[model samples]
Target chain A: MSRHRLTVVISQAAGKHPVKRALEEALVAALIMESGLDVSVIPSLYDLSPDHTGRLFLESVHGDMVVLSWLFPRAAFWLLDRDGIKGHLGETLLKPAADDDDDDGEPEAPRGIGAVDVPERHIYCIDLRDAATHDPFIDEVRRIAAECRTRREEKDRAASKPMMVELGTSLTANGTNGTNGVIGEHAATMPTFTAEQLLQAPGRRWYPVIDYSRCTNCMECIDFCLFGVYGVDGLERIAVENQDNCKRGCPACSRVCPEQAIMFPDYKTPAIAGAPVGAIGSLKIDLTRLFGGEAKDAVAQAVAERDRELVADGRDAVGMSVGIAKRQADKPQGPKDDLDNLMDALDSMDL
Target chain B: MGSVSEPLTFMMGKYPAVLPAELRYARNHMWCRAADGRARFGFSSYAVRLMQDVYFLDWQVNVGDVLEVKQSIGHIETSKAQSDLFAPIAGKLAVINEELLKDPSAINVDNHGTGWLFDMEHAEGGDAGTMSVQEYYQFLEANWENTQRILKGQI
Candidate 1:
């Protein structure tokens, strides 16, 4: 075994999001039996608390880490930071396609690579949507592990000699100079990770992660959500309380949040899946409502999508009866399309 | 009356999709314009109007990748659906509109101009299966109902 194993965090998806499940399963099945990796499957990272057992175990590690979760890279990076697992964001060449592939300009390593308690350690936060299939994921993980081994080997040379000299002095003082005694002391440094050491329990959870940067605390989400997935904290700010109460595959609540703050990171659609397209323009779930495209209004579509899930779940369709509120200045108008301008022109005549 | 719903009907009253006479069109609703023997590609206005809104787009192929006709080069995503973008003409990808990846709604705003998908180098057999603007419109009229079904998610 290597001197220190890199912890690979597999944050399990909440609902049976089929593609997420399939890719996650493929990854876990392939990686679990590997010797060098310390793999742990915790519940969704978005819902994790700093005090959670799994998170505490994660923080205890003084080495490299990899986090696989259903979140945008930006969201996932901040989520890890929120959970007290901090490291420089590891760059992955694997995007669906990166905006700029050339790395010639930024030649040096990012500023804070080894400037901490753990030198040369990084947190490779891989979005499950980073690729379509598991081969890319598998290749990336193996590559990361190999890179970690190389870093450790380089660090060991500089750090190991001083430790050995110090150990000799301590051993002589204790009159334990035998080869077996040295062997025993060295063996004590070997890391111990068993099935029970992983702190978090396994449970499927699905919920919205409020990007507080964008959330205006409008309570529009709380008002719009039929399920009790959202609630207020002591200060009455929105929080995802009762996350599992979120209806599976029903992203209707996301469509209704006028601020576009809600993100179902595992959700299939890019904006809902937490792609950083932008705040307002990207999150406009019904972009057609701007131009003369959509047949139904935003609220109507959301209600229909929500009601389908409700009916499927053997519940009554609320159908705009509950959680429907008139939003004020709901959407910031982009420069009007020709259609919008025409509609404005016609509406002025009041025909 | 064609009575085709959405984009087609919606476009009929105001600023219908104008097909440039010089451009060549693939049956899959992609347009290819030749510049200095290289082909520049994008979604046709009809295709863009049919899509309604483009929320996100990502290329599946790299800039240097050699592609074949009908090969899914990337996908364009709107609020409701994600559709693969097939290569309109087969050649090595010379340039992709990286700007459009950031804000794919540009496709909805200007599918013909700044919203072009990619360019191909030393592109081959440009006239093979492509049609002129009139012929493409004829093809649309011929397959109007089936095309309507596709747009309506029935097929």
Candidate 2:
């Protein structure tokens, strides 16, 4: 059996609602335990200061998985961004408070509406309003746990480390223009991206690249990429560090580049290599059937026939494509539907 | 009483709290003002500046509910953590900025105006004990200095 260790950290300043807090903590524990993962809940009285919180985050990163709860101040996000901590986790889960509607004087129960995407990780900002209904959060957590367990066992049995892809660059700081001198100064100063923005894709722009010739050994980028992307090599050369974790559009390093050597490549080419492939391969299904000339006329004829049939039956073609696709696909199971379900399941998890 | 013109040594070196005159502030960084009987309130610009990248705002209270002073009214989640919003004074909630529930970044855009969290009707004479604009300014000045000291390891 693969041993999965999960750690949960709650904010010290989450008020004195011990009962609510305990219930939330217990629910999280139960969800993990149900997945057969060994879980530990560590309660600390440390204030959520950036420096202090960053230290706690670094400690928790070593676990097989981690969950953070409680009322985290917006300032903590700036610290995390500066440290590039978001790039390290598989999931950064958030449970929004249930009584949030009470604060707004709204009578309706709050809903889960926020999500944030980091490179390989997904951050779910769940509304604690739904905490009473553990089904939504726990169901999601179980699926992720199952997937994680499978991946971990496969890697462990093979005795192979996860391949790290070097993105080939580093983030260097341009001189402080007397403006916000940091990478995510907007987040720190304006709270621009938070749980609300989580539901929408938070903007990820500018991938960092490094020029070794102009690079001095000054360790500023190393301190900034908190994602552990920059590190010293055997010869002590400040080289391209942890490139695998770099987000597709993170230009944070370029903004900080003192030598202006970092460059961001446009990634709009929608290459199929990054897409998922089925067992039989060959683009899974014939695109010609959907978009080829002969198929187009056939499809049009079929649509007209289906529409007439629907009109005659006093029904619509809403279920026609689904029924036909199910028949043509043999198994009648659509990968798109499965993938959507999987993404939803992953989003709902409390991990 | 000290002698006339004699400077009394009464912690003169301590910083005084100072807040912007036009801005209303709460103990938790929310700002409010009374227009007629209803009060308009929102997160201060200073608070928005401190909390960058706001992702969610969980406002649970609604119109007609009576809120007590200093009670947790709502919370704003940023990329990193969630911060609670506290009521500045006891009053009946009148309206909330519903736009923020969907787009919390509006607070960062114009914290003092469009980002206003909610509105309330102050209890009659409730403004009596509240700090004047000048006094609140002093309070912020002193508080900011103390925070700086704590950051500097002076506390």
Candidate 3:
């Protein structure tokens, strides 16, 4: 069978442990498997240099599905318009109203599977957090797979024209310049902070500190960070566009900052202390307590009682003396009669 | 061979260092060995440590089946997630470990030994191109640091 490609993009900050990465990978794989689709898990797309983030976005546009696990509001806005693709994840989940059809006779299309102007192929995007919490996420993926299969079958029968399809992720916090405004102008805009603002000694949410003394204005940190945290002010000063939307621990902007101007005090602290002990390795069972020392005798007694009940009900027909005696009397003559019939047929046919 | 008392001496000091090696490392953290020219493979200790508890092992390829490099051979289910295991090298699968199908926890207990997944005969000249033990350690170090940065939102 030919291989079908499905690309998964996990947008997370750098510095996560291998265990967490493995957990995320396993979760995504399980979701894919629940849909009953054959999948090949790709190595992760790790921290992209600011210069490379745009190129990476372009490359990721080729996937059948693109998943944005974290809340990168600005990045979602920027990637809405690029053509030659299926549906988007953030756009569908974050703003379901952006979808044109309310009743397509399908459950809310999974994150990636929907119609783009280009073709009938569907792309799905899932919010990692939402997927972790909601059982519906699994159900939705299965539904989307069914829909895609149905659509594909119909297209094959009708000999419909093939459509070009691509999937992508938008990393910029502010919406890209195109059909959808950055940060979604129509939706109720939430407060967000740039990495620079977040790094400026955690305090009040507004008026994020932009260290003009170390500002390079390269916009690299802005490009790398998914949240539209950094923007140029009227006086050409780098400023925080939105602060409230920033997740408490994500410091993507500071990691990408070449100038080292952006700094946050509590940003890098671990959510939990110590190396996490794996849950599976610590499993314990007390069978002795569950089933006392007389378990073997009890099992034997139960088996004996079950056998006696079956014999009394004549359900053990094969083991009955009368049944065995009848079989023994008929067995020899049954095969001999079959052989005689075969010989008679051969003789009559003059073989 | 070392003396039997060596264990006591080592235990008194510290356990033998089980460094993450490169020779047996898969991109997904599995290991491979060449046995009589056939590739014997299993999950690395690091992979088991990462996965924690393996409840189920599901294989995609069957015996006498040809597999390509980077192909997904099967998946292992853990409490947290279902992780796919990729074929590090291309070859025809010779046999699978029936024990893992019956008792998957063997992988977490003795990942390098009785927990091996399958044996494969190289198709033509299929080579795993795996790293040495030292190289794998370096890879893990780099990967660990990168993962940390991503988690911290630094990258």
Q: What is the lDDT of residue B127 in candidate 2?
A: 59
Ranking by lDDT: 1, 3, 2
**Full ranking by DockQ:** 1, 3, 2
lDDT of 1 by residue, A305-337 (tens): 888878887999889888887653575667885
TM for candidate 2 is: 0.30
Cα misplacement distance, residue B28 of candidate 1 (Å): 14
Off by over 4 Å in 1: A1-6, A10-64, A69-71, A74-93, A98-123, A128-204, A279-294, A307-351, B1-155
User: TM-score of A-chain in each prediction?
Assistant: 0.52, 0.30, 0.31
Instruction: Estimate how well candidate 1 is docked, as a DockQ score.
Output: 0.03
Task: Highest TM-score: give the candidate number.
Answer: 1
A182 Cα displacement, candidate 2 (Å): 53
lDDT of 1 by residue, B18-103 (tens): 77766777777777787676777788877776666787787879999998866656656764446556666667899989899777
Give the worst 10-residue stretch by lDDT in candidate 1 chain A.
Answer: A107-116
Candidate 1 docking quality: incorrect, acceptable, medium or high: incorrect
**Which has the better DockQ: candidate 1, or candidate 2?**
1
Of candidates 3 and 2, the better by TM-score: 2
Interface C-alpha RMSD, model 2:
25.7
